[model samples]
Target: MYERTARESMCKFCKYVIKIYGNQYLRKPNLNDIQQLYEVHESKHGFPEMLGSLYCMHWEWFNCPTAWRGQYLRGDHRHPTVALEVVASQDLWIWHVYFGVACSNNNLNVLEQSPLFNDIESGVAPDYSFEIDGVKYKYGYYLVDGIYH
Candidate 1:
């Protein structure tokens, strides 16, 4: 578990998403950082792109400077900011997400409370397929991780 102070510092990541992705975002848990977060979920976090190739791409996008740089030092636009990404695939369906935030359990909590995982609980599984327009559409976290349906 994260200390009160540590969790507070990590909250910047959550706030950034709330400001950008609105109040709707999934929360997982506070993670060490983008790198560590990827290590934890890459196994179950599928990839329609390829094996390790797409996973690498997902990591790159997650820590991409262009996509995520506003959460550092009072949202300063001059310094280098890191990006973050998450990807998952199921059967013939795949999901991809690129955003800025620490991938910690605590951070996930914040995300869980956001609009992303508003209706999901901690133990529920994500849904990978859904019907749309008389056809089945693959669905999952596009830019955030949470219950997939």
Candidate 2:
């Protein structure tokens, strides 16, 4: 069936992407990357314990399967959509990206299911610390749009 072919093709593409750029771009930040981002964001942006900005966007799924069309629909969007979430730096380095699964069929749903926090929960996330004014903080925070609020 068309669904099976499409699914297989997507899986192949994902594997190719991981093989090509996963090690350099998809991996978490290193000690130096952490240090520089922390310092610049603190001094320049006044966000002392900042990591990066997190955003989620919806992409219209015009070719969505007939059975799943209703699942991805929203009140505002006339068509079904899938979500793409990214965490990026001011310098435009995409620190994180999550997409593909139909389970995350909207921005808000994507946020809930996103693996962005998995590294931290698994205790393998890079360790970084920063002070704001005079108070020392343990964890970094992202600058998110009001939709997340």
* Count of backbone clashes, every candidate in sequence: 31, 0
Residues 49-91 of candidate 1: C-alpha lDDT, one tens digit per residue = 1222223211222343655444332232335433343444333
- Candidate 1, 18: how far from true, in Å? 24
Could you tell me which residue pairs clash in candidate 2?
none
Residue 71, candidate 2: C-alpha displacement in angstroms: 1.0
Please give each candidate's TM-score. 0.22, 0.67
Best by lDDT: 2
Off by over 4 Å in 1: 1-70, 73-79, 90-93, 101-110, 113-116, 119-149
